[model samples]
Target: MSETTDPDLDDSVRIADPSIDTDVIDRIESALEEGALADGPEVRAFESEFGAYCRTDHAVATSNGTTALHAALEALDVEDGDAVITTPFSFVASANAIRLAGATPVFADIDLETYTLDPADVERVLAERDDVVGLLPVHLYGLAADVSALCELADEHDLFVLEDACQAHGAAVRGDRVGGFGDAACFSFYPTKNMTTGEGGIVTTDREDVAERVASYVNHGRAENGTGDYDHVRLGHNYRMTALAAAIGRSQLERLPEFNERRRENAAYYDDRLADLPLETPTEPDGYRHVYHQYTIRTDDRDALADGLAARNVDAAIYYETPIHRQSAYETVSTAAAELPRAQRAAETVLSVPVHPALSERDRRVVVEEICDYFHNQ
Candidate 1:
């Protein structure tokens, strides 16, 4: 049997390294001292800073990435029976958000090299179905999706664009940041991301209506112009980011550029070091800046490689071993236009080695050496 199917194989090296230093604690303390620990100044400030970073007019903070996606879909008016075109090879949250917003998620294949939603497949799906109300594309593995093409499709089809930039904090396409390209883009501030807020997310957009709607959706549908009173103006949920999380998020956000640069340097090193190996390294197409959330490689012997790396204490992860359409929860609502062969192939063979900013040079060498040894032994 191929190593890709091995059940016991696992990545030994952990991928993320989120540092919470004294500065974060100081901010948290300030929030506590001011008695504004919940959805107060810190979250507001984080939103503004993050908005500026993304070059968006406004940003709405949420409790987590999934909530941000749900809120964005809600703002786009995704409702029951409405379909959203999205890549099948992504974290389940991308599709779950569509379902949570009362929409059906139609699966599209990916551009294997970029591992993003394929524009041709998306256009085909949109042309065939009139119920597709939005294009939900994921910037998978810190590489920006083809939002430029997706936007064109959206304009032609009269559909909204919601970018799932949960893993693409510093990524950009054609010199524009990923978050501001779509109608609304969702970001994850989980510890595993380029930056961390312990647990949080944000929605960035240029549209005031979308910004206002998402802001309202996350805070229990309360009107924007209201006191700290509980007034249920519309159906909403308590998806507000905590002041504590926001405080930490601010510190991490401030350090994001530096962190992303380190990640890039590490990825470059891997590119040179692993060049001779019998595997396909990550790709960064022209006009796109990849943040290297996980430096994934494709190989037929993925499971064996991962197992070998794990045996040597090197953690390699398979970002999405199962495509969204194949998951049981989505079996009923999800429909693929045709066979998503590229996405299927990716699910079976892709493996992510550590490319976090925290990795030392020795750690990088160990990762490459283990994989090299694995293939050598085989």
Candidate 2:
């Protein structure tokens, strides 16, 4: 889509990248020395900071993003036979979490441009289904979904909204952050996400009941901390975030905006250069902000392009080579038989390039040039 590479540049340029700061290392070293690595002060500090960032009243740190989502579903009291509508184009965790929480996941197609769940499609699914709890639209590739319309549908259906915001830590739709739009939001702090805690996740909620439910759900259903050591309120899992992970998360959260900005800057460079290409690049939906987590693009000849990039020693990835609904696990429950054309198209044509924050101007140029060259040869 774009080409601005220097002839002398190397093959290390990528589509997305993660930003790392020495300050994070320093924070980790200090935490380890002070034994502040598990559910410690640093962990508490990160939960507070993350909650504040998401404009929520509470944030519960969990072992992983999947647990964060599970906690939300638990908090909402989702049970067997309850249905949750979600896009099939997202990470399997989105639907998997629903299935794990004893809920049925209804598949929905995504908006072609934003690659997020389509509200129209969501409504159609809801209209034709029953016992639907709510929508769990993912902010795919750091782009926000059509939350306003989805929220309207939820209001009309009297359903709960639990967002799978793991890959969209700082993304916004309609001028509102992903976490702020839903009843509860889940985020992953994996190393590759916009931010990292080494490994952890957080759940945000405005409702005290939901917050308390998730808090208890994460810690073996303990009703009180020091009141009764053996008291168990409800069934729970050991999905707690370790202190070390929280320590790193605290540092990373503070630097999130800067990291997101770097991603945006790199994406801006590609947007300017790839305007003339035959490939279809990502687009920010109306009134939404894209954080460019993967900087994915779609080309009719994705396999050829990927092979070409590989031949040049550049790294390009095919994200979700198979749509989740098409997977064997979902086949029995899936009402549609690989019927999502856009999802299937994206699965075949989409390619993830490095878009991490560690990229330099020279690196961006090389990546763009390699992609442009592949298309030109085709």
Candidate 3:
């Protein structure tokens, strides 16, 4: 693992470590040697392997998570004046993607316990709105959102469901992976994510139409079965994944199971050690496999706790200090922004410490010790 530490933190324990082992290097080297740097066979193979991993029939590779999301929304035909119900308590990208697709993102309160979209609130939004055309639930911090219930609601309301599974690559609910739950799901391979491809993303789905549309959209709207390479069909963007990123992604995918297991183990250790502490540890609902992209804890004194860790040279960070709806950009875009009290509270309290797969025993111990010392001393 090529572990990176922050010099400003004085070699502190990292919140995440993107493992670029020899396998990834070798794959990239091979691609470089063959001059296969463009969107080609490597991307195709990665898509195939990733689709199989996610239990989906097709996976459309893209330049990054944001593009994957935009492409998916476009494929669903969510356009101007259409509103999509989504959680406000995630990385802004979740809602930003909807806005980028020329649609309005309607805010819904989250279930504070899970830090994910609350189906009840979603239903309420659906009840009050006539413009809602889709559901975009984010699997925040590697916990699978209650997609099953959300999907059922979508069925009743005749709305499309697209999961923002960017933080939940390997997470599952009741033995089934997240990508297959909704109409389509998106995964990110950003450096800090559970896995890394330098930078890349993919859309996983069983629907052939969605897959086809995403593929074309990512490739400048070129017709799949067009007579010529330059034949344009619909207006699209250059969101295609490069061969180098795909090569790294394929290698990372092979190691994802092991990486996720280590994260789970570290989280389990935190759960046991932090049980009696003042802060609230993360929860894994029954039969759900939480991949622990961020082992976040909630406490009213979140800032103090984070400061304490930083002073001790232990890296701790906030995943989303500001909920999407509260951002300056979304202030006017979403009408329900002020209605998400749970999301507002979560933004002020949640702090994620070092729980990446690459953390050493000493690193994890320091994290737990510093956190415990902070509360105990207080």
Candidate 4:
């Protein structure tokens, strides 16, 4: 088996580093001492701080990004028989969350350059289906989706828009942060993401109704202003974030801007170094801030290039070798047969290298040199 397939056989440059320093440890210890481990003061503080950072009126913390997405969908009242239009070129979680909310995910193509939802294809999807009540656009690889255009299209159709900012913690579209673009946005704090919350996520929204619904949905559907603690008014799940995770998230949130800047710097270095190569580097259009979650590039010879990088002990992985609609889990979905040529082509050609903040100068140099040498030898 190839090193990429066999984890134990791989010894390459680190792709991500979720290192927790003494500050994070101290926060966790403090949270533990507080004796409120489940959705207490720490979680509330993190939500408030994150909301302020996103420039949104409300932010609700959840156990993970998937749950965040689901909570946001439920808060929007998207349920059985309703359909949502979204790009298929993303992690399965994007689609799974739609399904978990009792809605079907309608497939759309992506912009080949940004690898995000194509508003034109979204319009085509909307024209074909009247059941698409919402639009879910994933900010793939830390680049903000064209939320402005998507939201405009949604407005014409009177549909709600939800942003999947799981990979784009600090990314912005037209100078405004991603989380405030649509009706609501979801963010992931996975260790590999721009920020680490020790496994947590949050939903940001300007609407108080959406915020209140999401908060209730994630906490066993407890009534926000009920008579007692067990007053469950609606169906919900136990997707609340722990105090420890919230504590860590608070510290990470404080450093997210710095971390994203380093990632952008590393991506710029790659862009300059790999300019003359045979591949197409990432694209950051005017007014859009790309946080460089994965510094992905596109090459027709993607498989051979990935193998070459592995041989040199450098890490290069496919972000989504299979688009969501093509996955076995979505085989039975009607959108599986949708003709998303751009998304399908991206699945075959896209490759993501190390662009994390943890990468050193030498590490970046090594990655560039290996790729240049690979092309030279060919």
> Which has the higher TM-score value, candidate number 2 or candidate number 4?
4
The per-model lDDT (C-alpha) reads: 0.88, 0.82, 0.90, 0.90
Question: By lDDT, is 1 or 4 better?
Answer: 4
Give stretches of model 2 more than 4 Å off: 1-11, 14-17, 33-36, 224-228, 336-338
> Candidate 1 clashing pairs?
11-316, 12-315, 13-314, 13-315
Q: Write the per-residue lDDT of candidate 2 for residues 1-378, one digit (tens) a residue.
A: 112243366545644345556676677777788774555677778888899999999998999999999888989999998989988898889989999999888888888888888898888787888879888988888987888888899999999988888989899876677897889999998878998876789999898899888888888898846123768899998898987788678777888898889888988888888889998888986688899888898988889888877776667888778888988898777554747888888898898887777776666777788888877876
lDDT of 2 at 9: 65
Q: What is the lDDT of residue 147 in candidate 4?
A: 88
Candidate 4, residues 205-283, lDDT tens digits: the string is 9999999999899989988854238999899999999999999898888889888999999999999989999899999
Off by over 4 Å in 3: 4-11, 225-228
Candidate 1 wrongly placed segments (more than 4 Å): 1-13, 334-338
TM-scores, all models, native as reference: 0.95, 0.93, 0.97, 0.96
lDDT of 1 at 341: 95
Taking the tens digit of each residue's C-alpha lDDT, what string does model 1 give over 1-378? 011212236434557666666787788889888787778887899999999999999999999999999998998888898988999999999999998998888998999999999999898777788888889999999999888888998998888899999999989988888899888999999888999888999999999999998988898899985429887688988899999999888888888999899999999998998898889999999999999998999999999888888888877789899898888786566483348999999999999999988776667888878888887877
lDDT of 4: 0.90
Native-to-model Cα distance after best TM-score fit, residue 157 in candidate 1, in Å: 1.0
